[model samples]
Target: MLESLTMVRHGESAGNAALAEAITAGAEESGPGLRDSDIPLSDLGRAQAGAVGKWLARQWDSVDAVLCSPYVRALETAEIALRAGRAPAVRVDERLRDREQGLLGGLTELGVQRRYPAEAAARELMGRFYYRPPGGEAWTDVALRLRTLLPELEGHVLVFAHDLVIVMVRYILDDLDESTILKIESNQLANASISRWERDHSGLRLLKYNDVGHLQ
Candidate 1:
């Protein structure tokens, strides 16, 4: 069983900022759409990653292994964080990549509403967990991937991935029901925030959830 796990969403990416802008604008204007794999980190993202690195440096003894997503944004965050802290090198894991957005790849929520209203309605009716956008993954698919990856982990490990990975890992680790998971995901997680779990005799216990105090 994994002894300890720490997960963090990648630093703010160009894609992340663009999506937020579209959400704020109600997706009226063309959003900054790009393939998930191509997104790069923003300036603030670099600073945020550096901040987390300092925090990680203080806890250097707590981490023995590090894993990261293959996406550009996530990979950059891991590189920057580890480099700043002078910590252990990280391994790339495709399974840690963001849930495929597919047809919903670049569009904001409002874009989904306007361009694919039927699909949007179906998603709301079926609920977010089961709603797989065309050519994309449902939450369950991501959950299965993490479940498989869990057994592969050992010792103190740190993960740098995406928002979905952070949330779904909890869903699997805690044995949460779909309804419960949805409730938690609705709040979402901020970019560069940290979430951690430690194992005890009973089971894994959440030590932190979406913590960004270091950035402050």
Candidate 2:
């Protein structure tokens, strides 16, 4: 079995909190545009991160390494988790950043749909995984970027990245179709939710997904 690697999403962000409001507003129908990448995490998100770190510490005697996205939310989550668990130093990588929302960035979902119905519909139908932002990347693009970061592989690596990045990575590992990519749960992961994987002769197999037992 390949050494176990733990992948987790950053703690709660303005996006996650706004999610309920966005959905309630029916932004999809009204066309509020999607938000951009700069949003930071909420206090709850930070606490969740600490909880995750505590959980990791209890579960593993030691974590060999840490890799994280350069984004503020992800970086903060990684840092908090490491500090809580006494984890190793974390290495920041742009390859692990969230999916580019493109022209849609900063707009509410309904706002965007109303403003650019065609674009919004296209993005929803085609999904962001394979769809490229006007100047941004497709889901495949993100995966390619992450591929460059993969080493021969190391021990107990903890990765903190965006939700879309997490989903696309699952596609790469599971060999799932881009069309069906969104069908799988976004795996946005609770503030500190964790997923584990192990590589074998065949490939990496997910041992767990969206585990937030630590928060409880």
Candidate 3:
């Protein structure tokens, strides 16, 4: 059985940079209009991934299995942090992919308000957990898929995924509700952060949350 699982969010990506810039500028939209799955890592992201890889290389004796989202940023992070597949072979899991942003994929709140007003208003009213964009997914959708994925894996599993993926996984393990989970997401963690949890006789117990000491 899987004793423990360590989840790592992909390093900062070009999308991340653009989003940050958009927020800084309070723009109408964000990101480079590229497919969300195609965005690559930024230079800082590469350095962060290298640092995480070295840290993990020293800390973990072995990883029994590795899973990753197929998104380019997540793939790059897994390659770097695992030393280019020198560790456990990475298995791409569609369930581990980032939450589908849909019409909101590359837009900020302002952008959504300007270009997708009804969608934006609906999101605010429906809440983040169940707000499914026209062609995207809800947070609950991501959680349901991961819940299915967990039952089939075992041993020490390492995963390279995304921010929403990380938070949803935590919410699943902790058995949190919409209110509490919303609170959890508000205090966002950094890129490339790691979190660990162990399963025992009782249940899942968190070993770490948003750990990034190696980047220091």
Candidate 4:
């Protein structure tokens, strides 16, 4: 059985910053104009990752394993954190990648409605949890992959990944339903925030959720 699990969302990326700007400007494309997997961190994101590493150094004597998403932003975060904390090397896991947005990859909500009305309508009908974007994986699909990964992890493990992956982890571990998970997702996770669980008699129990105290 796993003793403990600590998950961290990657620090803010250039893509993150771009998306926010795009939303404000009402742009059709909300990403950094690069493939999602290739986007890098912003300056603040690097600082945040460093803070997470410092927090890790203060919290635990050592972590048994470190895993990270293969995406550049996540990889950079993991690298920065590991260097700061003197933690073990991270093993990149493709399974931990950000949710593939597919055809909807860079489109803002307005863009989605304007460009792909049918897809937007379909997504509304299916709901966010089950709505697989044309060529993208749904939230449930994310959970399925995490389910496979969770069982194999043992001891204290740290993961550096995306916000969606963090949410899916909580959904699977807590046995949460669609409504509860969606509610949780509504409060977007902060950049470089921490979520953790520790094993007890009953099994793993949540010790923290979306904790960003370290960043402050």
Candidate 5:
């Protein structure tokens, strides 16, 4: 079986913009719109999506299918990229959604940390790959879902998800443990950047990781 899999994270959202502004102003305040799902993309995010779509349109004959998280930012990113070509069938899979934040959802980084000191400490100590938000999922759980779904994919496929999802899925596909996975930068896969991998006799091989030059 010939399979080419490409993964991408959703574009920057209003949450991102808010955070950026806060950072620019040197304020540690948290915003109220950083939900775990369906955060709309910002203007820069749209630009990134368009650029990624154009790049992908040139890189492959066509995407066989697009599997996306139901989050608005992810859906928008996938739609923008697919529309650049003949447009592939888009499928919504909850398994691909962002890490659930529970009460931390819709809060800024400071807000989450301040609200859930123990959970925040846990996340910081364990790293994002293994960190589990209170009343939320752990990386192992996300890995299980991805493992169950990945083998079912056929042909060329594109997945649009969140940073943690990408890292966890990559960990499973690459057969790496927490150590190696933890070494990877969380933003290694930029907002519209794409990472490619394919299966071989040995197993899945990493052809590339986090290619965002197209956005430049």
Candidate 6:
């Protein structure tokens, strides 16, 4: 059985900033132009990663294993945090990637409504948890992938990944329902936020959720 699991969301990326800007300005596309996996972290994102690393150093003596998503932003965050904390080498895991947006990849909510009304309507009917955009994976799909990965991990493990992945981890480990998980997701996880779980007599219990005290 796994002893402890700590998952960290990647620091904010340029794509994250662009998406917010597009939504705020009512633009159609976020306009990062690059593919999702290639987007890098922003300056503040790097600083956040460094802060998380320092906090990690102060919290625990060592993590048995470090795993990270292959996405550039996640990779960069893992690298920075590891260096700062003098942690072990990281292993890249594609299963830890962010939820694929597919046809909705670059579009803001307004863009989706204006450009793909049918899809927007379909999504509304299906709800966020079950809605799978054309060619994209739904929230359940992410949980499926994580299920395959969970049994493989052992001892104290640190994972650096995306927001959806972090939330899905909680959903699966906690046996949460769709509405509960959606409620948790609604509160946007902070850049470089940390969540931890520890194994006890019954099972793994959440110790922290989206803890960003170190960033402040």
In order of lDDT, best first, we have 6, 4, 3, 1, 5, 2
TM-scores, all models, native as reference: 0.94, 0.83, 0.95, 0.97, 0.87, 0.97
Q: Please, what are the lDDT tens digits per residue for candidate 4 over residues 21-93?
A: 9999989888777889999999999999999988888755648889999999999998888785656678988
lDDT of 2 at 63: 68
lDDT of 2 by residue, 119-150 (tens): 87777788766567576677778888867766
lDDT tens digits by residue: candidate 1, 1-216: 589999989999987787777777776433345567878899999889988888888877878889999999999988888884645778999999999977877776777888889999989898889999999999999998988899999988999999999999999888899889888888879999999999998989999998999889
Better of 2 and 3 by lDDT: 3
* Model with the higher lDDT, candidate 1 or 5: 1
Give the worst 10-residue stretch by lDDT in candidate 3: 54-63
Q: Which stretches of candidate 2 lie over 4 Å from their true place?
A: 26-37, 59-62, 124-127, 186-189, 200-203
RMSD of each: 1.5, 3.4, 1.4, 1.0, 2.4, 1.0
lDDT of 6 by residue, 71-178 (tens): 999999988887856567799999999999999999998999999999999999999999999999999999999999999999899999999999999999999999
Query: On lDDT, who's better, 1 or 3?
Result: 3
- Candidate 1 residues lying further than 4 Å off, grouped into runs, are 28-33
Model 2 CA lDDT for position 41: 78
Worst 10 residues of 5 by lDDT: 27-36
**Cα lDDT listed for each candidate:** 0.87, 0.73, 0.88, 0.92, 0.78, 0.92
lDDT against true structure, model 3: 0.88
